[model samples]
Target: MSFNNGGYLETDDALRMLDLLSQASGSDFYMSLESKGKKVAGEIQTLFSDNMEVLEIGGYSYVAEVASAPGSGKGVARGLPLAVVRDCDAATASIASLLYSQDSDLIVNILVFKAGGDNADRQPFFEIELTGGRVSQHAILTGGMPKRPCEIIVFSYRAVEIKSAPQLVSGIRGAVRSAKLVNN
Candidate 1:
């Protein structure tokens, strides 16, 4: 599903989350935004056009575009959206369980979200895309909003070749571990 305010994240938080994704995937990132028709989405849409230019933060680049609303439901999405409960330790445990349940070598696309303060299912979050066993793309909504999506940040990574359950577990563990550090 498209992220809600409970899943929202600020620009700085999104970038910090990117650090975790980078650590887990062992790569930098190519970042962009996909407008989901929210208020901030409009601000972003007005800032850039299809043929203008992209902005660079730290070292990575970001491009923005206006788009239709993302489809509904969890599976309407193509990636796995992970919300950490209690702490990253809990997240790691859940990731382990999820990997073990899967039965094949797969390319995992995880959208790690930091839930909203009141609840974990709101909005205002960023997303990442993983393909070909590396972090290739990231989607984020950023502006000077009054509140952030969550204390934890979303971890976006690309196609991690989980050849075995152990590898899958380790990759996600690393991502969660990095998130723990970032969260604290």
Candidate 2:
């Protein structure tokens, strides 16, 4: 469906659309794109059916798990977290907050992608950050296409058993890619 004359989908309409997508996908795709926290994490875990603890901080959610130590017999704790904010501005702020809350020695690497505009062919704006020690990664992407008004942020704590950050990002991309409109 096209946006209203305002060139944007109304909040209610967006929420309704999210609900429909969530129901159809049986994943928290809607919540992952709407809210930012445990709700999103819970929805994501549903897709993989991997049991993990959900943790929330500063409007972001994470999947906490234990991973095997590289070449070791022990296990290490990690987190797979995500945040879905409204826009790029919010995403930036969220990133800043996340940095402040973490250790000062943390090193963050951010990469952004924005080529197309608002057209259907436009690629969603995307940013990915790998935190220090490769312990965690944070990613943010514009909802794009049918849900152009929102941004999705995802986090992946590198764990041996858990999916990598890029892999988790691909899952979110898959959810958005599968969205379709049907005429009644």
- Per lDDT, the best of the predicted structures is 2
How does each model score on TM-score? 0.19, 0.24
Over the stretch 42-92, how does candidate 1's per-residue lDDT look in tens digits?
Answer: 111112222221111212222222333678343222334332211122233
Best by TM-score: 2
- lDDT at 46 for candidate 2? 23
What ranges in model 2 sit over 4 Å off?
1-61, 85-144, 154-184
Q: Write the per-residue lDDT of candidate 2 for residues 1-184, one digit (tens) a residue.
A: 2246864435454444332222122222112211222221221222222332221112222334467858988765554443333333433554435544543223222211122222222222232233321212233333433344333333332221211122133232222212111111
In order, candidate lDDTs are 0.27, 0.30
Whole-model alpha-carbon lDDT for candidate 2? 0.30
**RMSD, every candidate, angstroms:** 19.7, 18.3
